[model samples]
Target chain A: MNTWEIRFAMGNEAIAEGALAAGARFYAGYPITPSSEIAEIASRRLPQVGGVFIQMEDEIASIAAIIGASAAGKKSFTATSGPGVSLMQENLGVAVMSEIPCVIIDVQRSGPSTGLATKPAQGDVMQARWGTHGDHGIIALAPSSVQECYDLTIKAFDFSEKYRTPVYLMADEVIGHMREPYVLHEAAGLVSRKQPDPSEPGGDYKIFDFERYDDHIAPMPPYGGKYIFRMNGSMHDEAGFGCGASDNADKFIRHYEDKITKNRDDIVMTESYNMEDADYVLVSFGCSARSAMAAMRLARQEGEKVGVLKLMTLWPFPDKEVAAALKKAKAAVVPEMNLGQVASEVSRYNERKIPVIGVNRVDGSMITPYQILDALKGLYLKGLSLKGL
Target chain B: MKQRWEIIFSGVGGQGLLLSGNLLGAAVSVIEKRQAVMTCTYGTETRGTFTKSDVILSDGYIDFPEVLDADVVVSLAQIAYDRYVDVLKPKTLFLYNSNQVKEAPSPARQVGLPMEEMAAQAGAPAAVNIVALGILTALTKCVQPTSIQEMLTRHFKGRQDVLGANIKAFEAGLEEAGK
Candidate 1:
């Protein structure tokens, strides 16, 4: 018997529902435009499911609260906008260094600093990658549609649990505010944090046991569990005590980076549309991918062989898939709300030396299909000129 | 049936433009089992400012949510009519509230209706947006009137008086378009 239900919902509502479906038990957040709906829904629905919801004084407190909740063995998450995300950066680092499992939903708005409170922008792509001022690896997922907003939020929780790290659901105002139809399905393949074995010896429980675990990820027991261990924000030894040794610092730092980099295959996801035997490629993520898809369809109608490579996983960047697409295409177009954030990444993988164009919009409006098609037409004209020579 | 239909409902804030768009979207997406995307743009203030909702109904996947080429455009305010009149294509069906906007020279096919007057006549002056929606339903036939009626019944479930007035307003709109 199928248990799916179809409903018309906004993207922000989908994210909140997705969290509930993924077994998120606690939510702490401050209201912000484009993302306030998530917090609103969570505040009302979390309690109905016997979960907890708290409206923090600010974004800093919000992140700190969720970190505290997750440390106590709850699947916790928070939602906010770009400015709020900027405020949460310090606490975000604490989650990273302490290796606490949590999810942060950043519904991006136009900004260098609250540039446009209610408008959508993809300016936070680089920020999500290196926002917290650390060399640590991060996992960020972009959702272009309401359905993805639902599906990827659950994936974010699963990744946070499996890897014991904070994951980002990088949404934009377009997806957050826009309403569309989506099906709610029973979540399968849910991952929870590995807990320390209760039957084993209780004393001297090394919280960061790299040597015992081949994957380098140690089981994280709750605060009130049998194993009492420390969670240090500073560089620490395997036993979680503050260690100032140079080599100890190196090992733990490398452990943090290697855990994600070594497991890239399991973490990264990308979608290919009309990419089979295409000469032109469009690389985009977040809301911009929708425009790319529309442009690809229009170009196809005009008999232009254009394809789209949508980045579902933003961080631990899909290097292999991007490099492969860039190598095959005659030319590439990177459309984004920001000016060339993801385009720079696409160009880095441009080993084929083909022309990589950037279609950008920051006027608080979406990058329309016509704008992207214009870029493709320019590339087509350039290709014709080269062929004539 | 048309493979795709892109419609825009534009007016000042508090005119129930977003509600009209939502009703149409829910009708097609949920009742008809088709795909629909509704995106609304408004200012920080809740009322007396320009507001527009773009609804795109498609038989296949909708890549871009905004209207690239509008099949039908409904304007209930002069600012909205002025904003979109020049951008419309010749084949586009442009609907306007004659009570608020003066007839403008345009290439697109134009249909003018007194939505405010129709709503008052329907005994629901606040439901001008529903009257406009009714006219849209009659002209486009994108979704069945019964589908929209089902949505209205669901939307105004508790308020019987409002529901009756809105149903009468919607019928008034459908009747005006038919004539």
Candidate 2:
């Protein structure tokens, strides 16, 4: 085990190093702008570390290759952008339904359809949650800085392996391409998948065991192991056989969501800055969170009683934390690259009906701190006017 | 020293703006044990296109990576200089290439160095970016000249000729700044 070493690194480089540190032994990805660096670094580093790096023909094949590699018992992952993720959505469902442990890095660019190839955007927040066809719980983490790009990628793998599902490290082009100083520390609290104990098993082992593990998560042994079981993508029984019975279908489908939701306490992560006596709250994630933090600091310097709630975990939505942050605030501001993907989500938890303003920009540039600070000032004055009434 | 310094290196692509920015960032963050963040912007086409690298160095945390207000702005091309000259803060130190940028009408305290001539005299005309970096370091003292020299040695380790030329270019830049 090596000690911590600090170095200046790009966020993509940090993420690549993070994946390697987290014991990722397989990478199959298609290169895209703003994300090509990860594939480039993985290509050089994985080979040196005796891991496999494959450049599949397309995004669909790249995701499928990773799913196959994960099932074969290698910690596997892939990196891509929006169009690439759009291609991988079908296979992403395969990982979700089959419960394969893998990591997918989406270095988001401006896009509905390749809108700006090399520019940064946080447009994929909602897509990361609901891109695939079915209703299933997903784990996605957004990194605000190069350091979080390193830390959260390791956590992404840990969550994936532990929950037996695909995980996303949702990085925008700004965070992905920007360079900063970060400490490379050995990954602690690393969790590998729970493989079945051959001695304690009955005649046949359940691949999707809902009984033994109260979390509805079962042991996932490698394919060549002595425990022979089917890995079904359809509505499946504990034995991995397809089941059409209405109750079994309902139970199995609910298990996918419950396994994650029941463990939300452990899964959801958030960071609150200056929230103790905050009158206005700035809620954001990914690169936009950096702007929000800057804006909050500026507002604080002016003594406006502002704070920031940065959501590290994008999916499973960190609802309780967000609600708590909004509970005490007079108004909430969401700054995102997209029009209002996360802003709409923030509005849902505004039970107080406080104004939730979104500082949106899709012009292939970052949402500046002044833009957010201006929005904060507007909300502050509006509060004053209401008090005057 | 100021608590934080925001610098922008603006030029056309293929001018090594990003490399210069990265070198400065590494020197400050790695050697000086401070914090630095650099974000770059460039068009899809690689060469002869608009490009800029924004570097922020702080003794404390840097929340926003991009340069909101530049303290030092280095422009190596007329296009680059023209784009930023009008928007500079009055306190900004605007450094430009004397050969490339002809006009300089701005509120900033401007210094036009013969960076291209310096690079040529240093025997690596392509190392004009290094010359600009040298001038930036000399003018601001943002990082120790020795630290940048160490980074240059490491950055161009395998190619001895390139290393020697860049080191000379950097020294030339430092000397020009003294003049």
Candidate 3:
């Protein structure tokens, strides 16, 4: 084992390192701008670590390969950007319904369709939350720094394994390429999903049955294992068989939902700075949080009781903490690279209209500290009291 | 005491921005045993689009990932200078290629180096980034020159000829800074 040490790595390369450190054995991805480097590094590094790296023909196949690899009892992952993520939606949904454990990273660029391949955008925040067509649950983590790129990636894999569902690692172009010093721990803490019991008869091993288990997260067996059950996208029962009954749909949805919702305390992760008795709070995530922190410090120096709330877990939105912050805050500011994604959600909780300010930038540029400071000044000039709700 | 500096390397694609970022990062991380992170961006156009590589080196944990206000912004292209001038603090140093960036200084401490001309003079036109790195270390003392040389040797350990040219280019840059 090696001591913790700081290392320089591009965003893509850092993801590969994180994935490998997390015990990822298979990488299936198609090269795309801003994210191709991830594929490139995986190709070089995965094999060196006795893992497999396959460049699939397209994003669909890439995700499918990971899904299949995960089912074969391997920790698998794939990296993609906007269009590629769009292509993998059906399979992503498939993985959701089948309860497969894997990690999918979207190094988001500007897009509806290749909108801005080289530019940074948080447009996919909503997509990551609700991109699939059905009412399925997901675990999405947004990393603000390169170390988080490595650290959160490990967390993404862990969450995927613990919950038995596909996890999303959302990153923007600015973050994907930006370099920072990060410490690589000698041994990363990883959670591997429980494999099914091999002693049971192959027919008796119900892959999704968990009536006797403690939680909704059903243990699964790899294909070669005794539990050779069929899995599909349709709502299924304990046997992993599609059931059209509405009751079955309820059971199916609740299964994965509980896996995450019940574990909310363990899954929900956030960072707060000077927010305990803050008069005002800033809610921001991803790269924009960097600017928000700088702005908050400046605002505090100017004698404003301002603080910042950074969200690490994007999906299963940290509602409890957010609501508590809002309750104690006079006004809330939501700043994002996107126009109004998180702000829209903040408004729902803030019915008091305590001036939930939205500071947004959609240009191909990263939001700077000046823009954030300007927004604070504008809010102050408007005579909005920075007090508690 | 080990001091860590987060340096943002900005230039256009094909200017070896990512390569330079990697070289500098590898030098610091692999040689000095310091923590380093490097991220790069290349616009759609592979040849003439704006490209940037930001590197943060630290002895402690680097919680924030993005560059807030760069202590040193190295611009090798005109567009890089134009786009990032407003981001640098007053004390921030702007180091640009004398042959490429024909812009005025936006920072209190600014120095333009003849990177292209110097690399050409050193008989390695593609070593502009290395030369610029040399000049940058001299002016800012951001990283030790000897440490960088150690990095250079490790970077080109397998190729002696390329190593020789890069070392030569680096010396030329050091001499230019000395002038």
Candidate 4:
């Protein structure tokens, strides 16, 4: 295949293209602000490629359809906004317990409920990590730009396949509606799930559980495959037979936790900007990482040794790498669109002693470069120093 | 070792700021064979508030990819022009439509062009974006005009004849900017 050139396309269009490239044959979603375009594009494009697109009655049904389609062997995805994300939480829990591999795209807007439909917000940062209940772990990657919207969506589906779990593509309004040149690489390492061995006798198959929890990600037999087994959200034994015992319940939770927790190194990702020998470090993710990089470059030109740690993966947070960077830096500033959601995590590494400042904006607009630069200047004037972490 | 530029295009929604930035990014990526990234944010207020796009063109992968201080800033609305004028780097160049914006900010060298009138004269009312793209290329010498034409042909092949007037409008913009 020839190397394809990157050109300008809307973020929604990029998502559709990425899904198509990553072998997602079905999409179920409802129309909502900042995310409706994904459904619109998918509806028009999926039919031509022999894929399926369905506009569900609401967000609840949308996620349910996605989960159902994935179980039936088609790679499936759904995109939604603030209110829609809230409505789909229950089905997401069902998907987690059932171990169905799918992708969820949340183009987040400002609000607890329908606050600002078209405005940008990182308020759902924590929500993406802990939206569903119980001891289930999910892979969530936040794309800072339109190109990443394409690249990360593919990665999200791959992670879901590898772990036999659901993944979240958490994008904000700023990155969703933005038009950027998106070059689809022919060599973009695409990952597909493993199919169960057909040669293994049907009676020996276990769909949900096994003797050991470490290999919790068992090969999933797709629909129409020769293997025969049952799958459910309820607690089950090694043979996938329904079991209500407390030990079975404990083992189920352990399987969910072990699959993700053990692969934290492979899941966590961060990009450092001029971090070596830096006096100050700025921790930012999603759209705010764009502004933080801009501010860092300007500060460097003006003779300030400032660096940035841009997080590409939100869940399975890279705590070790972040802590190491914060150790030698004089101060750390976290700038985000929400009222400092990621700053809470940074504070967990070192509290009030590290001169940890937060530059927050809740006005549904991105934090500008001047705001971050001013915060850095204020920290310098106050002579606040970093704590020895 | 290679040419790298960070360009920003800011204006109102209907002014086609995003289109201009996209055109530049496309030209740089497809024609120049460089890795280019463009990102934008338009206000929820529809056509009234300022809309801005940041474009970064580099030979290597752009990791810290944000438009900090632009090497070139283009504006079609007075509000966007005034907002970024003083904040832009002293070396940064400014290009604005003289028909819409009458005043130029201090310090930076400003090149004003009657691009809307030129596009109208070229028989395309909405071709002002392509017109601005041509003028920006001529002023900065960042991408070749021939490469831009090749990119436009590849990008608008489906539309076909719609590009004839737009190409003429771009040439008119180049001529007007020269004066």
Please, what are the lDDT tens digits per residue for candidate 4 over residues A253-351? 887877788888988888898999789999998889988987887788887888999899988777777888798888899999888788888877763
Off by over 4 Å in 3: A1-3, A351-353, A385-389, B1-11, B22-41, B54-113
Residue lDDT tens for model 2, A1-389: 36798888899999999999999999999999889999999999999989999999999999999998888899999999998999999999989888899999999999999879989998998888899988899999999999999999999999999999999999999999999999999998799888776576544667877667766678888776677667777888888888889998888778788878888998899999999998888999999999999988887787678899999998888888989999988888999999999889888888899899999999999999999977876765775422211
TM-score of each: 0.96, 0.97, 0.90, 0.86
Extract clashing residue pairs from model 4. Answer: A6-A183, A7-A181
Model 4, position A178, has a per-residue lDDT of: 66
Model 1: lDDT of residue A214:
76
CA-only RMSD, every prediction: 2.0, 1.9, 3.3, 3.9
DockQ of each: 0.83, 0.92, 0.48, 0.36
Candidate 4 docks with a DockQ of 0.36
Error of model 2, residue A374, in angstroms: 1.5
List the candidate 1 regions with Cα displacement exceeding 4 Å: A384-389
Q: State the lDDT of candidate 4 residue by residue for B14-89, as single tens digits.
A: 8777777777777777677777777776766768688878888887666444576578888877888888767766
B31-95 in candidate 2: lDDT tens per residue? 99999999999999989988999999999999999998899999999999999888888999999
TM-score of 3: 0.90
**Residue A20 miss distance in model 3 (angstroms):** 1.0
> What local lDDT score does residue A296 receive in model 4, on the 0 to 100 scale?
84
| lDDT digits (tens) for residues A1-389 of candidate 1 | 14788878899999999999999999999999989999999999999999999999999999999999998999999999999999999999989888899999999999989788878999999998888886889999999999999999999999999998999999999999999999888799799789877687876788788668877788998876677778888888888899999998888777778888888999999999888977889999988999999888888887788899999999889989999998778889999999899989888888978999999999889999999988877875775422211
True contacts kept of each: 0.76, 0.91, 0.57, 0.46
lDDT for predicted candidate 1 compared with the true structure: 0.91
lDDT of 3 by residue, B70-177 (tens): 778889989988887665777777888879888674753677877999998998899999898888777767566787888788778999999999999988988788
